[model samples]
Target: MVNSIKCLLLLSLAFVPFCHCKKEQGVNLYPQFYDQSCPKAQEIVKSIVAKAFAKDPRMAASLLRLHFHDCFVKGCDGSVLLDSSGTIISEKRSNPNRNSARGFEVIDEIKSAIEKECPHTVSCADILAIAARDSTVLTGGPSWGVPLGRRDSLGASLSGSNQNIPAPNNTFQTILTKFKLKGLDIVDLVALSGSHTIGDSRCTSFRQRLYNQTGNGKADFTLDQSYAAKLRTQCPRSGGDQNLFVLDFVTPVKFDNNYFKNLLAFKGLLSSDEILLTDNKESEDLVKKYAERNDLFFEQFAKSMVKMGNITPLTGSRGEIRRICRRINN
Candidate 1:
């Protein structure tokens, strides 16, 4: 028995380097728990995100921003979660755009349903996490099965948003550094960038990258001309929704390898996405790697999500199960 154990240990150690080399391999991050009813909760969460938009169309962008900001800052904390006092416990950031009032209403409705079905049982943080997952699934990728039981955060940090989240126009290295801080590898970074595969961005976000092609601000750039031309029509150099751009062309609502193919065609919409091809050969290699293996991308996406979900989460005694996501329970 000891010999067999030793053999297994040795075999694992022997394969370590190979594993490391393949770490940059593009792969899928689908959750292993996917099933007919397994993603039912996630489906509910997606509806909630969409409803947020439906309630207040303007809040749609901000709500999406809130999700990305929250997850990128400290995993998927329910920091976006509110309490009864109308007071946010964590670092109090600015309120979500009032235009999102309708969206907040939708979020409230979803929470109410869960509360009715399993009052105080589900964590708002998990809801946000699942919402993000559901959003991705709705955008056109395989639905990833997220492990449940995430608790709400009692402490919100406005500071986290400025410090941790990557800026839209930051260099590839800057983005890498931020991702590394989150314990994500290059592959994970590449995979996460795939989120852009189906979302829209404002022209303001990538204008500098578009016009300042030779400028220091635009390092190692290679954006597609056709895409740029399209952007020009909607967002001129002088003024427009610079923050606007689409992540994926095919099945924009589904999360899949289409983002990678976009990269391959030099049609990646974000400066961050285009920069991957120029600054890091490995990142570009990953794009190709993932593009070729849809299943692998789903697998990696699942694992990376698990890792992302575990980030500075409001675990243990840090938070509460809010009766409503927008207001405190007075």
Candidate 2:
């Protein structure tokens, strides 16, 4: 009886380490990841984001989009933050990002604050996720507890940025396919695209719709003529490619369902935005549902943002906690 008990004890002891190892090996992201390592990590990120938002209200939108762009390309690994270096070509120069993607300076500010508190402790990927949540809440949107402990990538992927991130001109099917490839469904696509509720788009992004949507001289009939006229005044045909237009004219700086309402009225700013109403029946129903119920939109938007943030993350010794958001650790 004593010999049998000793063997059972050994077996149980061996199983304990195996269970612990399984957890360490699995994707181990959670909201309290830094509770012990750096109790103030989320606080530091939120304070910096709030400062940026106060300085420029539009910054909230810019920061939110930065997170989305990062996740789509390299699975929220902070590859989007990498600057061009020895062998790394930054995604910042990609077609989708070139003159559009902003908020890097704000991220740098947050990273500096975090490093001062706990050097080399918090990951840039986690910082972006937290900032995104704070930005949404600051802009009157619903918030969620962001899972932390994501690690930064050692490199960037310009090709992935260009190919994976949907363009303003991409067809409805193309955009849906891009999201689907990322393990997102049609509901996720519509909910995530609601980020347009607070951002701005370059005139060049949708100027084709104002003039020639189908390679012809006619304007896109799907757009409201009066809205198109207002856009044409600022966007013009010739030299206003860089001029900015609010994505949601009704609630330009607020995170709300007015983006979907505008789509219902045929006033969505980009072809991609309008297609949710015009192209697919399922998407159109979602747009109508969200437009009618702000609570539903907010609920789904929060859930979808959390889902987007969970895309293939590097954790458990796979990647480093970048000291500076813009460069790999030395």
Candidate 3:
């Protein structure tokens, strides 16, 4: 065991690299998990993600969001990647993921590429994690060493996806509570929310804040009227639910602290984004710190992402290395 681990370590410095829930902690995941087993795993994922992002800059955010959504539903087990099969209710059909979650094609490409070189040696869950990190780096965001070794789940959970993923209109407390339930805290909530620095939000997601915030038919007072008006031109009072809006108005494609800066200016697109500052003192302080020091925000964002990626990962013989990400092995 020592010699094998040593070889794995040596190969990890240069080249390479689970099935169940043991204690519900991601203790088995490490950056070098695939060093010897599938030395090219991370390389293949990074290449595919870069190609996809270059083709459609928005692809970066889409891929990043995929990891966040997948981790939330079933402990980063790749449950979100499953297609509805016999007895498997796909998370893709859930309310939170129905029209929002995407990037499956990109994942397919990465998985296929890696399979050509490593067979079933790596997990789709790890692919999502690596792709997300690559996406962030492609978008001018800070990068971190992503812990790996998570195994793909045999079943998907539509109900868990619907219930676990936080909504754009959820209250600050509700959002924070959702994070806490996932073993995260306010610091993680604030740092992870920084992901809004890149993605896009659909009109329906934040329409409540624009026209009927609090059901009073008044725009959210926290939102800048000018910005709201601009959004209204595209979002409108009725219809256009599928219309897309940039999350960070100033730098839509760049991953930076601009999301927090926009929050301070009341230009934040989602009610959930604005409430980070307006609702909780600790949350507000975090917003100000990120907005003021991009370096601090980058540091915390890296730490929070690593923490989030560690959520209840499947390891050991707990799960299977899926032959195909969209379905279980035949």
Best candidate (score: TM-score): 2
Models, CA RMSD each: 7.9, 3.5, 7.2
Candidate 1 yields a Cα-based lDDT of: 0.64
Instruction: Give the candidate order by descending TM-score.
Output: 2, 3, 1
Candidate 2 segments exceeding 4 Å error: 1-26, 213-217
TM-score on alpha carbons, each prediction: 0.73, 0.92, 0.91
How close to the true structure is residue 151 of candidate 3, measured as C-alpha lDDT? 93
- Please list the C-alpha lDDT of all candidates, in the order they appear: 0.64, 0.93, 0.91
| lDDT, residue 250, model 3 | 95
Worst 10 residues of 1 by lDDT: 94-103
Tens-digit lDDT track of model 1 for 179-216: 98987889888877766655566666667656775543
Candidate 1 Cα misplacement greater than 4 A, ranges: 1-67, 81-105, 213-221, 328-330
Residue 229, candidate 3: how far off, in angstroms?
0.8
